[model samples]
Target: MPYYMFQWKYKNEAVKALVQTPQDRAAELRKVVQAFGGRLHEFFFAFGDYDGVSIVEFPNNERCAACATTLTGAGANDLFRTTVLLTGDEAKAALAMANATNPDYAPPTGYTHHS
Candidate 1:
């Protein structure tokens, strides 16, 4: 299973709804993730650009995409924007591959220094 981080900012309506009906959103979130054969590791509310974040593990990207699509399609799209995150190990592997390739490019001869 691959891990993912989902970050979101709540819309005004969502905030209002939460105020009106305070609930254990983590439980609801867990159910959603479980329905897709995934596990919700952590869910948290924060003070920042994003209203909340969730760490989850799913079978693959397609399952993750399905979860996001289902949430967004079912009116959540109006209430939040979601971002997918990658792990440090995944990034490191990508960097290693890039370094192995060592792509190089030449600047155009007409290019001039601005600084």
Candidate 2:
């Protein structure tokens, strides 16, 4: 299973709803992830570009995308946006593969490599 970090920012409407009626959102989101054959490792509210973030593990990218699409499709678009995250190891492997390929390319106009 691959892990993902899901981040979101609440809309004014959602903030108003929460202020009027606080709810156990973690439990709610856990159920959604479980339904998609995924596990919700953690969920937290934060202060920054995003209002909340969640760490989850799914079988594959398709399953992860399905979860995002379903949530966003079901009225979340007005409430928040989601992002998929990758692990450091995965990123390192990708970099290694890119280096192994030794791709040949020239820089844009007015730029030159000095090596």
Q: What is the lDDT of residue 84 in candidate 2?
A: 63
Worst 10 residues of 2 by lDDT: 75-84
Give the TM-score comparing model 1 with the true structure, all chains together. Answer: 0.77
lDDT of 1 by residue, 10-51 (tens): 677878989999989899889888999999999999898778
Whole-model alpha-carbon lDDT for candidate 1 = 0.81
Instruction: Please give the CA lDDT of all the candidate structures.
Output: 0.81, 0.82
Q: Which residue pairs clash in candidate 2?
A: none
lDDT of 2 by residue, 1-115 (tens): 8888887777788878888999998998898899899999999999988788899999988888888787776664354555567689998998898899878866798986699
